[model samples]
Target: MNRYESMMNHLLVQFSNTKVLQAIFCAISDELQLLDDTFNNLKEKRWIDTGEGAQLDGIGEIVDRNRLINNAITINFFGFENQINTTGFNQARFREYSEPYLSSTSLSDEEYRLILWAKVNKNNSLCYMNDTIKSIQFIFKTDIAIVQDIYNAKFIVGIGRKLTKNEILFANALDLIVRPAGVSCQSMTHFDKDNVFGFYNQKFAKGFGQAPLSEIFSNNLIKKGYVV
Candidate 1:
């Protein structure tokens, strides 16, 4: 999730009454727009397209370096950085152990622990979680464990946004799957049917719950009578 997405989701969790939350949502949305110049959700459109038949399937599509013409372009989103909450982290963790402590074998585990975290003023129906959500006037409770290396680690935790199309392209080009912390599947609604896209469908069976995002693309590109 982007910072704004996180904020919106957290807002949903915070308030029960829908009507009251709308005002707050609007205010935040307005403020975010004001910050768009410096910290934007999408890149600036500064390039003029060439009149030639330069073509790319999508805005972020990779072009053939040797192609006679290509219309590939890059977008940059100046997103906000995650703000670490040391106090909130401490409160969330079990205070009994000063250092990170978990009773597991030598085998390291990085399960659904990579799950995103959010703040709630009171305990509502959720999943495996931290201690409290009402203490801090500001700041959210996000997983910070993904970046840490703990002996006999039981879970993985991360706090970051999902990969954009351009980012996925860069990672796929290198044949390297960016980890959960760095990138995740884009939402299905954002995808075009035949474009190469990544998704995280939880179909776990083996000892691993951490499934890398999968890609789909070009399956129907050469249908019998399709455009040649």
Candidate 2:
């Protein structure tokens, strides 16, 4: 067997080790049989690669495995065996579903979010900045002042708003905006003269900026605002 196949076999063993199937259904239960059928079907498909760098192939295999697991969970635990439907199976797939789409060279969500949030908030210079707040929150360590500064400066007004020194330091530490070495600025405006914001805007703005904040920032600020 190739490396991918070996990995799939390992995963299959891990799934069975959970013993979730046995716990959820009697040995001869129809649900158990369904689970067995799903598992054996996956094994028979020989879709998994037992080698390194087999992420793409593994995704399909892992997804099939999770599907079987979820089916077993839903039927035996949730007592939804009668409602065995495949309509929403996609959501239960593993995180590896996105592995193929990612690149080793790509900046992490944290890095991308920091860059986009800094640019949008700086360029628009608009209060009531409803978007990209979550990106800011996720990229930076959770600091209430930093969040409030970005929010109140652009979202809410007449609220006696200012970013604390610590918050400014934190934002600066992200280095989302490139600046000359040893230069210091408390706010984004200091870098505006050289179009520093524009520089970052051009580099990190595409794809990263456009991605859904929920995916990029771990919070759905837009949905929370009813922006849809």
Candidate 3:
């Protein structure tokens, strides 16, 4: 039963059937429901996944303090020398590569939440190689490869085609933001069989002259998305 019915049920026996008292209790019950809804909304504001609007922004303040935007921006006040423009001869047009970049404005509610959640996991949880793999799986729920090159002090993240533009940007920046400092990160498209160099007993292993040369810099970097 709703609040109105529950309130009427508890009344003293003599007052239970009174129409005047029943009307007053019904009005009070409606007001109490509005408070219940507002209270629940306040409770949801504590989490990034459930918060909306100002509540979401409040959560962002704690997790994403820097408010890093999905896309990187480069600005140049002066025009570049010797740049050709087919559309027009305007130097201003040639110098400006894209529209002025706005921070934290281009992303949607879900995209913003994704960024915040990733940072939240990174700040609160383990961040080793395996942890990074698990974090990617939990945050993205897609096929991603994390290749570690300890000798070179670098790791590469291979993102598949399922991510959004903002997601791709966040994935590219994940290393610098989440991983230990001094480790370089390179994010790129997923490596296909043709782009990966192979070794003996490997998924894409090839003989000396049996297959074409691959463009990947190292054999350890590619092997069907496994950590090597």
Better of 1 and 2 by TM-score: 2
TM-score to true structure, per model: 0.16, 0.18, 0.63
What ranking of all candidate models by lDDT puts the best one first?
3, 2, 1
Indicate the residue-level lDDT of 223 in model 3: 16
RMSD of 2: 23.0
lDDT (tens digit, per residue) of candidate 1 on 18-119: 765666766686677567644442344311131112221221122212211111112222222221112343244333434321111111111111110111
lDDT of 3 by residue, 98-120 (tens): 54421233456676777777777
Error of 2 at 134 (Å): 1.6
lDDT, each prediction: 0.27, 0.31, 0.54
Question: Candidate 2, which segments miss by more than 4 Å at Cα?
Answer: 1-128, 143-170, 173-228
Error of 1 at 153 (Å): 70
What pairs collide in candidate 3? none
Q: Quickly count the clashes in candidate 2.
A: 14
Candidate number that wins on lDDT, 2 or 3: 3
C-alpha root-mean-square deviation, each candidate: 26.9, 23.0, 8.0
